[model samples]
Target: MNNEEAARARVVSTADRLFYAQGVQAVGMDAVRSASGVSLKRIYALYPSKDDLVLAVLRHRTEQWNTGLAKAVAAAGTPRDKMLAVFDFLAEWFREDDFRGCAFINFFGELGGGNSKVAAAVREQKTSFQRHVAGLVRDAGGPGHLAPQLALLAEGAQTTAAITRDPGTAAQARAAAETLIRCAFE
Candidate 1:
């Protein structure tokens, strides 16, 4: 990558890590510069503001979430299994050492009220996720309206897993999901 691109990537990665580990409000630009090894001047030139950097980090997190979920769904055999694969993805994610709830939810809690741009970004990301779940439910022979149920389960699982620090939370959600899917299919 070009120098600016590489620097920008480093800054975003550093910022994302810090923002996830600490709250976004807690991590300053100086910390990001120190962690990323990018100059403060360069970071400012690239991101313009902390809010801009946060937006980039949200985009990065969303892309990572989409890619991982897609991989899990693709590996599953049936549409129903594919629908269930979302929990499988969540299970793996919850098991990660640094798993810290949903990025959108965390970001929303941190800045959604004061920052209109961040709020909108969080909403759009969540809406996209719901749309994804809705498609999966429809494909799995569930009612179109049942999508929210599945999405809510997944969303709740993320929060519970983060709060409880338990990987099995995903499995519990999965079991609940199976019952819902079975009922929907019937």
Candidate 2:
């Protein structure tokens, strides 16, 4: 990759790490520079502003959510298993030492009210995730209402896991999901 791309990635990764660990509002560009080793000048040149950096971080998160879910679903053998794989992915994420719930949810709580772009990005990520769940439900021949129900379970699981510091929330959500799926298909 080129210098600019490399620098941008460094800034985004560092910022994302710092932001996730310590809310977006708490971390400054200077903090990011210190963590990332990218000069503030280059950071601003790449992101233009803290808002821009925040957006880049959100985009990176979006990619991670999409890719992780895709790989998890791809690993499952059946359509229903693919649906359950979503929870499996969450379980893995929750087990990580750095787990801090959903970045979109966290960032939205932090900046969504004051920032239009951040708010919109959070909304789009949520909407896209819901659509992804709906598609999985469709593929599994689940009843239509199951999509929202399942999505709620996952969302609630993420919040609960973060609050309770329990990775088993994913398993619980997966069980609830399995029940929902059975009720829908049976």
Candidate 3:
């Protein structure tokens, strides 16, 4: 990557970890600067304001998650397997030592329905993720309308696992999804 791109990436990567682990409101500019090893001036140059940086971090995370999910689905051999892969992916993610709640959801929780641009970006990112998952469900030959419900179940499961520290929630979600898919196809 070019120098500028590399610097911006450093900022985003650091900010992503901080923002995800701590609420957006809790993390400060100085923390980002220190974590990234970049000057405050450089951070400001890249992102004029904390809100801008927050939005950038959110976008970066959204891209990373979408790419990961897409790869997971693609690697699965069958449509049902692809659908099950979503839950498997979440189960694995929750097992990570640094795993926090969903970034978008966390951001939304932090903002608490503010009228900020970052809030809008978080909402958009969530909608986009749901749509992406929905598309995968459609490709798996499930009814077109089943995508939203499946997405909800998957997201609900993620939240439950994160909150309850129960990985079994993911397994149960996968089994339930398989049953739904079978019913839809039959």
Best by lDDT: 2
Candidate 2 has an lDDT of 0.95
Candidate 2 stretches with Cα past 4 Å from truth are: none
Number of colliding residue pairs in each model: 0, 0, 0
lDDT of 2 by residue, 1-186 (tens): 999899999999999999999999899999999999999988888989999999999999999999999999999999999899999999999999999999999999999999999999999999999999999999988889999999999999999999999999999999999999999998
- The alpha-carbon lDDT assigned to residue 14 of candidate 1 equals 92
**Residue clash pairs of candidate 1:** none
* Candidate order (lDDT): 2, 1, 3
CA lDDT, every model vs. true structure: 0.93, 0.95, 0.84
lDDT of 3 at 8: 96
Instruction: Compute the lDDT of residue 146 as modeled in candidate 3.
Output: 72
- List CA RMSD, all candidates: 0.7, 0.6, 1.4
Model 3, runs deviating above 4 Å: none
Model 3 residue 35 CA deviation in Å: 1.6
